[model samples]
Target: MDAMAAIKQTFFQECEEQLAELEIGLLAIQDGDVNPETVNAVFRAVHSIKGGAGAFSLDDLVHFAHVFETAMDHLRAGRLAPSHEVLKTMLRAMDVLADFVRAARDGGCVDAERSQTLAKELRALDPDGSGAGSEMDDEEIAFEPVLMDQSMFDDELEAAAAPPVRLFTIRFRPKATLYAKANETALLLREIGLLGEMAIACDASALPLLSELDPEGGYLSWTIELLTTQDEAAIREVFEFVEWDCDLDIESDAASAAPDDIDLAALIQKMQATVEAELSALSPPPTRVDPLAEASRKDADASADPGVIDLAKARQKKSEQAVGEHLGPKPDQGAAGGASQPTIRVDLDRVDRLINLVGELVINQAMLAQRVMEAGLARASGVATGLDELEQLTREIQDSVMAIRAQPVKSVFQRMPRLVREVAAMTGKLVRLVTEGENTEVDKTVIERLADPLTHMIRNAIDHGLESPEARAAAGKPEEGLVHLSALHRSGRIVIEVSDDGAGINRARVKEIAASKGLIAADASLSDEEIDNLIFLPGFSTAPSISDISGRGVGMDVVRRSIQALGGRISITSRPGRGSTFTMSLPLTLAVLDGMVVTVAGQTLVVPLTAIVETLQPKIADVHGFGGGARVIAIREHFTPLIDVGRELDYRGENADPLACVALLVESEGGVRSALLVDAILGQRQVVIKSLEANYRHVPGIAAATILGDGRVALILDVDAVVASSRADSAAFEQSLATAG
Candidate 1:
């Protein structure tokens, strides 16, 4: 690949990894469970990506990296603790960084407007105040020299005979008209320094007397002796820029000559020809030289007055203007400057490949352990003990690799505050966003998928669940409504709750909307939970008029779909005139899930353990049809919606075999329900989620497919979609019964 292509690829890869690490680290920090090492890791991940981008001379990456690295530096040094506001701002900055990287990868310039807005948000987090200068003392200053060490060179020489060093004598002479051009000799020299070491001697013998001099004319020349481990082609790079401007000659130094085995004669001849071509380009025609010389002399004489003007300050101002012009506006320029933080850009595909490899290794390790147990090799010889040790080591390695993929949910959480502000402003609701447990660690894939659903839920909480400012005051609550967003580990799953303390979902309005939308009949008697879930129905909205913020009847349905796509579920709990909480339970990682492996009519199926509330064998008397094939089992006084999986999947041969069925109670749009009629309950295991879209296509009731331990592909049951489909069927059947009556 070309330099730019390689750079773009590397940038995106590094960005993905950095984002993952940022999510996990921020989540841990927000949960108050992160350590100094974790904080440092998070900071370093961002810093590394920035450094890599800088290496490619990408300006947009450098600009944002500088700002983001500064904030992370502060956090790393404990100057800034994980606060709700700071974390939110950091998250927003990360989003901007992601955007910039994406734009750069696509060969587009950074989005100036979005970048400026995000930078302002990041700067506001560290406004001039209490903790400004405290973190400086703790910042670590470290460096990695690019030069090869003498000891390493010696060791290599001892292993394989040392390669011959080449020395070249180079003469650089600039053309008389060269000074008029914008190119600088110093910059050229700096570029050369990146290649090798050299000694220089300036020749000013051609300089004329002060009276006869042209100040702007180039008179100086340099003879340099370069001692490099690189060949003659490398030496030519030093003088690459000045090739057209100067007279150049290159030859091998006799003093540094090695054996005849390593010849330098041909290399020296090529270097001389390369330099000559470059120098010839810089030489101008002799006809126009006199006028330029005269102009230079006159200009030099006119500026001879020592006290004529404050030229230094004028030059400084001009330089500042030039910098401003090149860099555009400096929105956060006043905050601080001169922070040395190294960053690197990595290719996200590579990181993803690495993660996949690690996941495979984990699976292989499990397989090996299973084989060892089945073989009954505990009493075997030394090889058995070594295998045990290897297994332990493998486990540790797998854990470390998995840790590299762990990212905080902070970046995903960060966009919420701005969203909340916007939605609140639009709805005229005074909503204060209270974020907790932002540091919850999740895989990168999960974090990316979670952003949209979280955004919709937060918007729903502010717009629909939270009351208006005036309404809040009248209800004897604080004038400003509180929307609490929290994430925590609950039963091995990440539970994210978007709760609002305002007038909760009005059940009466929900029922009315549901009735009008034909989602339910006017005479249908539903529990409070079922009534609350009516909000998730497609085309169901209680709002009388649609607004720009929401209530076009599309938010919750999308949220539900998004959550389900991630192999997660969304649930709601509410009290009339109080507030509502939308709880989303998601797996820690999307790559693999802890699933209950069960067999239904000889086909193995995986049900996400998170969705399995309680599995039981329901008595035949408990299962009864209300009307028109709508089955409901009386669980205490409340009736639970029941569906027979065997009948639903069209499985044959056991429709009425004692009516013994296992009920996997799952939550959905119609609230919690015991899914009746499954053949048997199987053991639970962690199964890798494979995309059905790759081989086949999406099946309505099947969320995804996973490979069972026995190598059979088992479909992961989509409890929510199945429940929704079953409920729709029940509603249709009931309507038919009404028509028949």
Candidate 2:
């Protein structure tokens, strides 16, 4: 990439972070957070975007961000109350600001009408129309003593007193990182010039000979003479981004401030000429190259780097990409101009490559250990001991690599608030989204795939799950419906729950709808769990007519399939007239896992160790037959249902007897416990996961397949699926028993 292109890339990258902060801070204020820092943070986010937009000459972005930041300033200064009406406008304006940014980044068109509409609304927020001055959010204002001429004292008697002109001597030394951060000294100097009359002198004393000087090194500094009505606070604000990052010192230069200081005036004049001469010696920039035009220019070639504008790519890639895609910005990149964690952005392909290499190493290590075991090496033999140590090292290395791919679910969660707002607006319902555990970490791939399912779930929560305002008020609930979204790691899996405090799924109504749709027999006797499960059935719809949201009976089924595709499960729990919660349990990483190898009907299977609660040798005394064939095993006063793994998986034609089989007690995501009847238990080991869906196709009860240390492919059991199948079997058995009776 060329110099300008690279710098433009960094600007947009930083825009993503600024946009995140802007939305979060606005949300915080809207949520009634009274922290001044939060309000200031919001102001700074928009201010930074505006500053960068000007540098890249993104005129539209600069204009929109200007008005938006103006309204945010009112909140920051406590000039405007965060009333629902006011915040709603600001939030809408934030959406426009994001559109402007994405348009500028991805070379896409934005609705000029929408931009104009929002700009007018934001401007209306500040009737006084002094928003441009509000951009000094980070400036530490100090009205220091300034010299007042005797003439000014006399002028107070005859006319009005004028503001004092303060002289600031700025010593700026840019570090190499400043350039690396894509910050230009020329841009900083230009911003400084906007404050007042400024003369800059380059200090090249530290510059080495041409052969000795490093091209990337900052061997020169500048002495700036600034005289303006603005305070030192305003002057320092110009360098706020790199305050502590670079060598910067600012103070009053009183002698220079004096209008009659002829010696200093002469020195500044000479420096100004020399600086201009030096600048003119350099090559001129392109007259037509503009970041603003390049991004949104439809006429541009296809080389408009997908990395720059990914929303366009996502739109083409996933049909489920909703209105919220690329709507909200990413979280704060870090501290201003300095990354706190010293993190670097790496391409996903590189990370995936590393993950694949580690998987190969894991497989290779398992093979080596198997070879040693088969060679009859003594347990304490040097080769055996060395292999054991190597195994441990390989496991640690694999974990570290997987950790590299671990990202907070916040990335996906950030987009949902926008989705909720849009859907709620479209439905004309008052809805509030409460989120928790956004900091909970999951694999990046899982996080990315979760966007569609989560969008569908959130929409469902608002459209079907949440009652209308009138209905909620009639039900003795608050007028505003609430949709709570939370994520947490439960039992070695990431569980994201979308719940709504609306009238829960009407059981009778759901069953009637299913029956009416010919989805189930009219006289079918169903359990509560089965009724809840009916939502996942394909082509199931409760809505009387299809609108923009949720009447097509498509989302819930697609949600189930998507989760299942990720080696995960989704279950629903509802209470009539109260609420319903949809919980999705997904693996932390799809790469590798520690599993308990077991035999079922002579076929080896891998049971996730995380899923296993305990192992038990089922005693005849503890087993009780429930119906025709199903049984419950009593363990510690808890009657857990029994599922014959061999029968559920169809590996055996006949169901295995509970007492004769060892039961692997496991719990599903929803806390449903079941005893999985396996023939015998093999030892535990770490196995690398190879997706069956990728290699072949998805199996019902099997999550994925992995190669064992014995060099054989063993299916990984989907514990949740097995538990669910057991419930279905139990329901069938009870019905048959009733018929027999």
Candidate 3:
């Protein structure tokens, strides 16, 4: 990529992070958290985007972000209240701002009408008319501080005084690191210039001889005398990004605030002398002197070569580290105490490559261990012990690599509040979205795919699950319905739920729709659970009419398929007049799995360990034949459906005898338990998952394929699909029997 393209890519990547923060802060404000820091963060997000857009000369994006930033500035300054109407407008504007960013990055066009509309609403939020007009011609609008006209004051004296314009003498010296971050002294000075009338003087006394000078070294500083109504805080905000990379000191002089008549050169010299005196008094003793400083002094005294400066600085840094270790851990070093750790951004492709290599290492380790066992190495033998150690190391390496790809689900969850608001507005429902466990981590790939299914589910919740305001009021519930979204890790998988406090699935209505659509027999006997499952059937719809949000018999069934496509399952539970919850359980990573190896009809298969509850040998007395060749296993007096894996996958023509097979008790995503009958148990191991659909083709009752220790490909069982297929066949058979009778 060219330099401009690479920088633009980085800008957009940073925009994603900023956009996430913007949504989170806006949502917090909507939730009644009007903390100053929260408002500041929100303001910074929009301001940063506007500034970057201006740099790229994205006129439309810059214009929209300017209007958006202006309104946020009002919110930050308390000129606009975060009332419901105002927050609603701000949220809409936020969505538009996000669209503007995406449009800029993807070379797409935004809806100008919508942008203009949102811009007008945001401008109207300003209590005064200052923010109500277009000032695109004012190039400084992005950096201009929020200020009120002095003429607005009632008292003449107050109007004349206007706010005391304090004089600040700021000394700014930027190191090479500052420029390395793409920050420029010229821009920083320009921002300070925007604050007020200013006189700036450059100090170059520290500059080394041309022959001795390092090109990247900091050799000059600027001292500025500014007279402005803005305080020290406003001046500091301009330098926030480069604060750690520069030495900055801002001194206020309210008594002598004149900048026009001051002698800048003389004043800076005097200030420098005073600062040097103070530093000398506080300096460490000679024995503890910084090596870099000593080296510089020696170079001056003996006229030594300046080439040793870098080596001395390295020595100084090393000495500081040694002393810090000798002093032991600092009280502030505790991670639990909230010390910020440094982080670096790496290309995601690199992390994925690392994860792939770790997965191969895991497979190779398994193969090596298998070879060792085949060679008849005893468990106590050194070779066997070494192999066991290697296995443990492989697992640790795999886990560490996986952690790199694991990201919090917050990225997906953060987009839902916006979805809920848009859906509610479209459906004319007063709905509030509540979220929890947003920090639950899952693989990046899974997190990316989660957004669509989650968006659909939340939309379904608002449009279909929730009732209109009047309906809610008539039902004695809050006029505004509530939709809750939550995510958490359960049984080595991420489970996300979208639930609503509205009149839940009307089972009668659901059944009627199913029958009318011919999805199920009109007279078929089904439990409430089965009726609920009917919604997952293709072409099933309970809505009376098709709408933009839902209906057309497309959403729920597609939701199921999408979830299943990720090796996941979705289930729903509802109580009439109460609410409904759609729960989805998905694997944390698609790359690897912990599975139990089992043989069925001489074919090996891997069952996900997360699904297995226990393994038991089925007794003859505990097995009973059910209708139409189905069987049930009695466990603790409860009869659970028993599925023959061999028969279910058509690996064998006949159902296996339950008593002779090992019954693996497992729980489905819906919390239903069943016993899967297989020929024999072959122990459990972690297997690297290979996508079956991508490599081969989608196989029924099989989730994916994996390479075993013996170098044979074993199919990984889709436990839920197997159980589901069995129930489906049994239901059909029973209906046939009813017809025969």
Q: In candidate 2, what are the lDDT values of residues 559-662, reduced to their tens digit?
A: 99999998998989999888999999999999999999999999999999999999989998888887757778899998988888999888988878776779
C-alpha RMSD values across all candidates: 23.0, 15.7, 8.5
Q: Give per-residue CA lDDT, model 3, range 1-741, as digits (tens).
A: 599998898899989889999988988998899799999889888888887888799989888888888888888998888998988898889899999999999878889888888988887787887655554443455575787886655588665565666778899998867655556777898899899877655554574332233434555677777778788899998997777679999999747444455565665466556544433343324565555444544454354222212223333433353344333333454322222344788998899889888888888888998899899989999999898899888888888889888999988888887788888788888989899998999999999898888887888788778888898888899999999999988889999988998889889888988898888879888889999989889888777788787678887888888898899999889999999999999999999999999999999999999999999999999999898999998999999999999999998898887778899999997688999999999999999999999998899999999999889999999999999999999988987897899
Candidate 1 TM-score versus the reference = 0.51
| Sort order, TM-score high to low | 3, 2, 1
lDDT of candidate 1 at residue 577, scale 0 to 100: 79
Per-candidate clashes, comma-separated: 29, 1, 0
The order by descending lDDT is 3, 2, 1
Q: Flag the better candidate by lDDT, 2 or 3.
A: 3
The TM-score obtained by model 3 is 0.81
The best candidate by TM-score is 3
